[model samples]
Target: MSKEIRNLEPTELWNNFADLNAVPRGSKKEEKVIQFMVDFGKKLNLKTVVDHVGNVIIKKPATKGMENRKTVVLQSHLDMVHQKNSDTNFNFDTEGIKMKIVDGWVKAKGTTLGADNGLGVAAIMSVLASNTIKHPAIEALFTIDEETGMTGAMGLQAGYLDGEILLNLDTEEDDEIDIGCAGGIDITAKNVYHEVHTPSNSVGFSISVKGLNGGHSGMDIHKGLGNANKIMNRLLYESQELLRISEINGGSLRNAIPRESFAIISVSSAKKDTFLKKINTTINEIKKELKTVDANLDISVTETSTPKKVMTTISQITLLNTIYAAHNGVYRMSNDMEDLVETSNNVARVIVKEEKITILCLTRSSVETSKFDLANTLKAAFELGGYQVDLSGSYPGWKPNVNSAILNVLTKTYEELFNSKADVVACHAGLECGILGTNYPDMDMISFGPTIQGAHSPDERANIKSAQKFWNYLLTILEKIPSKN
Candidate 1:
């Protein structure tokens, strides 16, 4: 709206993206965006259908002579992960994302840019509105709540789509075409312990870890980025001689690597000065060690004027031990594919409540058995620590099919357009393709997108040249689809 939104090539694509950004559509809150798409379809007089869970499908007839070609589905999610800097004052529920153009890249003002799938949605909308592109009969499938959960994909009924080939537009890299993705499950550890009021002689202080480069736990898990919750717990565990733990908390989303964490503890007045000195020294050591990765890391300890309430020794020990023992990074690498992470877990969040302490862990793996094995291992650890564990919303991984016809088409199209082969990969992160495959066993799928960075974090940005390349590649693919034999 301001200054005509510069550097937005492919006017239709930019128009839809800018328009969609004006709607508040975080995970599980996609009604506004979904309705907007439906309205757009109605305005164009195209056939549209909305399911109970807000998944939308807009149908477009084939061009006059191309009606006999196989139907293709253009798929992408409607929701985005809502993440912002701690100092940002914007509200995702009511405010639209503030985007800025800089050096040919589009990014948000201290928040996630939503281009992970928003760009996919815009491309689909652009195709639907185009009158010049040649293509088969098409269906644009817009799913909801993909970031938090694959709800729309899980709820998709068999025969909901008539397309045999689906081109997913949710992947991040422009040069890589993803044919498969890892599956994921949410593992939770909950424990309830009694609390007791401590004598009011000690000083209360809060220790915090902030400014770490948190990213998509799945995509960035193998990068050795620091987990704030893990680092904070390590600090507390090493300082127990001088400090008494009161409360601990960190991480906000299950899929995001924790960037900041805080813990409240009490220290004896006699050892307060010594405690601060050692803590600061340790913080400096950590900063030095992680300087190459988390260059902006900040660790601080400050005295608080609040009274302290203590938890039972049993609860305190259980919580601290669990945090210390739980695995929070890469677990294994793929034996078949070099450098591919086979299994990993993120100890995403920790919360200390009135009567319980809860730890949320997310496990992912390209192999289904490995995923379950890791989940069981984490659950066993929680049980050993005297806690109740629960696993929820487990989804299957999409196995790579070397013989997929869609992959062949995309590969050929890319080679013809760019005069080079496009990289085909099986990603370590989850994609909606897996769930869609489960519902429609015969559906052929492939995922490709422009370059996007820091997807689940505040520093998210989309590359301009990659967007142009993606558009060119996609248009070529659509034009080259052959008639089904």
Candidate 2:
């Protein structure tokens, strides 16, 4: 807790967030947050229910004279993405998020801020606790495991919610209303190779790529930020003449762009200085090439402990080729929407474990056929390189229904409250609405939120002014819902 973190509106949001953060709620591990919401509902004496998948639904009766209005569901995910800086030593399983305020923005000290949906969660809590705001029948639906997958929403029963109109408070931009989102799939390639004990005359060294700005692969795909894994592959390909590879590893989450990566290699003791000089020269050249985008990018090498065994020559070549051939960055932009990315792939994580190497890739596309095509392409590449591929955790995309009654009402409300038209569009990121819509076919939905930057990454932050505007807009929309009967 720093001195600068006190007295901000996001501080109030963080206080509640800290309570939620203290409990481990990573993807499938959402029982604790579910209980917290259940207990909060009990304290308020509201009608509360928890599904088998730990999704919590809390209902608040309509205000006097507004009981006739249709029930509205305020939806947000209960889980936050688990990511941290390489140097920060906090464990996500037990430690609370270390948050602080800088100027007027709220951010984490060295981790993701979780404001992607935490602010929405807190705003709903604030609304539920307030006795002054006037509103129609409301249901706060907190679904679990929205980050890793949409398990909670996917498991939702048809009659689980009584609301026909759903307001998903999950989009990152404030003034933009997101009506659709891209679907995603996870692809993994595993290769097991024999290791050989090499002579002790070889020196062990580590090569690293650092200082690149990595963000949400979906939102920042077009930003031209260098992927550390890709950068490392390029370095290895360039320096293979001077070094022998041993082990390589980087990244953790599939949704976030990797900012840094490192590789362990072996070289003859006599060639150490030349290897270092060559790597430095390559780093300088890459920096110059990416000067406009990754100005701070750096590549460095250092001496390290020798490995007991190294990959065989055949295995090493296969691994290097596979990594070099892996697809990355934006694959295509939407032909229908100018400047919008329709398909993309991220080679998120690479690890060497127990004589085996695993590469995890995440692919997203607004178009269903494109997503499958990208997945097939990756699968074929891995098979050609003689590796076993596994595909799992696929989620469907949510398509926009511009003709819905809820969108009509939201558009009118925005005009009435702010005297400006809301920017309505679709996104390439995943949202829970797609799964919820599948559960309840007739449900009408729209998503909006305060401005949040760098979501799912360490640079995450929320704007205070945008939050105030979001709260005001929500209050206006609540008071204007049409009657059900």
Candidate 3:
């Protein structure tokens, strides 16, 4: 089924991507992938080292005449976010990603294509293994767990390489050169709730919110797509007077905007009519609001077996109000860069079962102060509702250097190759350039890649044509690297 993927243009790059997706490289669970990379480097007769935190670094000598160019650090993450349609039957832990070519794009079957960083990783691997591509001494640094904590980048120490310039091939656009990106922190709120016996003559309904277009929370938050957690909360909040939740589960990852939610809720038989009316009303309003952005948005409710227990009234109300108070969309836009989202929040996951409830969120911003301002706002809201809020995995944002020599070289090279200027900009998505900069502050860094759409979600795909363009552009920039001063 995946043979077509290897047959794509730029056979070296696509072949590498196919081999990568064959391994189970989910975030933070990268032992096999790390070993896979190490073996590949050894097979090529290059010097390979696995760091204390599982990052793989491989060094290759410059090819022939390009020896005078400065040593370069080519980096991309080893792990990909694991997200699949609720109806898709696939296990990310043991099986390779199943991919198909669709109308100039390559996508996974009912799951994330892993092209976000996979394409970048493949590109770096292609460059490393090539004998004909002219380039300076190459240092391929593949860090792990970028999709979740970015701990791999955090744990990398200085002196790991002698590279003067870092080329990060993780950007999602073909025509954009990324100079800066947003920092992010994880917010987790947990609370224990008491469950009560099901009331006599109670009824149950399975509430489902699915078919929403979940994309990268940071990149697609501004598009006004419906968040399943928020939408599910709305239905529960509206029916709180008559409803009791037995079990609620929604969303998978904290970075992928939630696309589906499911809940087994109970209500007294007396209030069944009112409960249905309330949910139907909210469903209509949500459909109206998301019509432009989520035309396929689906919300439904149906009769189900009555569970033996449900959340206590007090706890039920608290969860509802807490989610309602929590912000789930763009908090602020960048005044420094046009069309740039400066700060945002994604109420990515919600769970309520037995005697426990947890809410997980990711807040991002290019500005440090503003990022916390929004995080604190959420902390206050969750705390007031009796949650123990904990913040973690904080990472810095990449600071743009518009005048760096490497940036100038890439800009001039791209214009010469494509006969047009690249869109140099900052992004809200978290990139490893910022965290890696902490250990190597003097290293010149830049990020650029092929066009990828619907990242961090099952709809993720890579543009076939844009990938070729990116490969051509990257090779030219490598050959034009100026000799060290």
lDDT of each: 0.87, 0.84, 0.93
Q: Arrange candidates by lDDT, highest first: which order?
A: 3, 1, 2
TM-scores, one per candidate: 0.97, 0.95, 0.99
What is the lDDT for 218 in model 2? 89
Candidate 3 TM-score to native: 0.99
Against the true structure, what is every candidate's RMSD? 1.4, 1.9, 0.9
Q: Compared with the true structure, what per-residue lDDT tens digits does model 2 show for residues 60-167? A: 988898899999999998998877777888887777777776777778878888887888888787667768778888999999888876788888888878898999
Off by over 4 Å in 1: 1-7
lDDT of 3 by residue, 1-485 (tens): 67888998999999999999999999989999999999999999999999999999999999999889999999999999999988899999999999999999999999999998999899999998998999999999999999998999999999898999999999998889999999999999999999989999999899999999999998888998999999999989987888899999999899999999999988889889988888899899999999999999989999999999998999888899999999999999999899999999999999898799999999999999999999999999999999999999999999899998999999988889889999999999999999999989989999999999999999999999999999999889889888987
- Sort by TM-score, best first: 3, 1, 2
Report how far residue 168 has shifted in candidate 1, in Å. Answer: 0.4
Query: How many steric overlaps does candidate 1 have?
Result: 0
List candidate 2 segments past 4 Å from native: 1-6, 10-15
Clash-forming residue pairs, model 2 = none
Candidate 1 lDDT, 69-176, residue by residue in tens = 899999999899888888999999998888988787889999888997899999999899999988899999999988887888998888779898999998898889
Top candidate when judged by lDDT against the true structure:
3
